[model samples]
Target: MRKVCCIFIFCFSTYTTFAQNVASVNGKSISSKEFMWVYKKNHAGVTSASQQELADYLELYINFKLKVIDARANNLDADTAYKKEISGYESALKAQKKTSPKNIEYNFIMNEYREGVLMFNVSEKKIWSKVHDNEEKLLEFYNKNINQYNGNDFSDARGRVIGDYQQYLENEWIKTLRAKYTVKVNDDELKKLAKL
Candidate 1:
């Protein structure tokens, strides 16, 4: 009975430690294993990373989570456009899974696509939507940067101008986003990653 109790306590403690949270935003926990999985996958091609490099990557990951949180708060995750896009992606992933159940490459591709969609939805809400809705500003941007446009008429050049304007807006918005989120890294977890 004593041995059984000791084993139970050990198992419970191990499970709790294994499921430890690496970071939290607001009140939501991000698991350490999940963070390490993503970090390792993303940096798999690299031979090694320093503690500083891992820390910098953690900041980027935290910022990504903050943006996702902001998107959820703003109901962007529930938006019809986002829903439709994600639904389409789910269907594609389902088909891929059916075709190749054990394909790591497919799994990585799907993960990349999902992250891309999330980033796209956030950018659409934060930057692209504003640039697209404000025709006057786009026109003004076109006029000021007219020399950069190579077209016979405004109609011909409008698409290029809008694309450039979207990029400009995205850059400015990223700067603001970096300032908006307070990021904290778990130094111990980061050191572990550095050792790996």
Candidate 2:
């Protein structure tokens, strides 16, 4: 009876640990904790998680992992883009480890390059063109969301009003740009990944 109880306990522990390791890509396990962190970071304000959402995200992440592995196998990791991404992530990790001003500066530069350059280029080319506004479109947007403009005098929220207007314009531009790109995710693959 004692041996049987011990086996049961061991089985339970193993199962619990295995469940916590969500997926293994190229022998690298992505822990449930890591997955949760990524999920929360991407969905800051969301209150609920749908199964489909989980599946889709998991699939996308696994595909990305596979791509990274492939890239390394093909020696693409030595390329500038791969190196930049790795360096940025490495710098961020190092900054967290040593909290030094120099490390902080390194992180800032890495973040700036990623957010300002790479992200800006991708977003501008894909999303900006869609939302690009001519006078007609701007006027149309203003007309549609007139309630936003009808509030108390602009003097009070002048900065906010202008920022909103600019963002609206940029959003339209991005919408236009995204129309040119072909982007699709496999639902079946996503669902399968969620089970992993």
Candidate 3:
């Protein structure tokens, strides 16, 4: 019957849409489209990928989405400076691609850029700031690892020392974030992506 056909069509479309998403991080749906964009970009020149590679990318994507969720939850997205930066970056991209606003590529790129800026801002506050704000701790770390620098003074090797400290802070921060947020991966959808 016509009604049966209509119901079947609606159900199929709904399932298709739901299946397109790979995971949900802190209640936000992360679509397979977004994952594909990042995966292809990162794994360029690879004609095909294995299931493990896809799985690894999925884990990385979930962690990144958690960071974005944290950034938005903290209102880091509302800072006027970051707002200006996103606006300027989008404006430049818009000028280059005179496509429809609803264009898939444009939307994906915009989402990536916006998330990148917001995550960077929150990370600066959470990790990088901690590394630079405590001179005593930094000096202590530098002294403890002075041999790593081949005898360079802390002042002369401050940049490298700060980088090493930043990595440590970032790792700890990610562990805390993983404990703070709940991420759900749809194994069926992820497996489907691997088949592609």
How accurate locally, in lDDT, is each candidate? Answer: 0.71, 0.55, 0.84
TM-score to true structure, per model: 0.58, 0.39, 0.77
Report the error of model 1 at residue 21, Å.
3.7
The digit string of per-residue lDDT tens for model 3 on 14-82 reads 778768888877767889888888888778845357778888888887877788888998999888998
- Off by more than 4 A, model 1: 1-19, 98-115, 131-182
Candidate No. with top lDDT: 3
Give the candidate order by descending TM-score: 3, 1, 2
Per-residue error (Å), model 3, residue 74: 1.7
> What C-alpha lDDT, on a 0 to 100 scale, does residue 132 get in candidate 1?
67
lDDT of 2: 0.55
What digit string (tens of lDDT, one per residue) describes model 1 on residues 1-196?
9999999999999556544755665555656655666777788767468889877777677767766766766777677877788778868877756645366555555555655667768877887778866889988988888889765466788878888998888667656665675544456666766777
Best by TM-score: 3
Off by over 4 Å in 3: 1-18, 45-47, 139-161
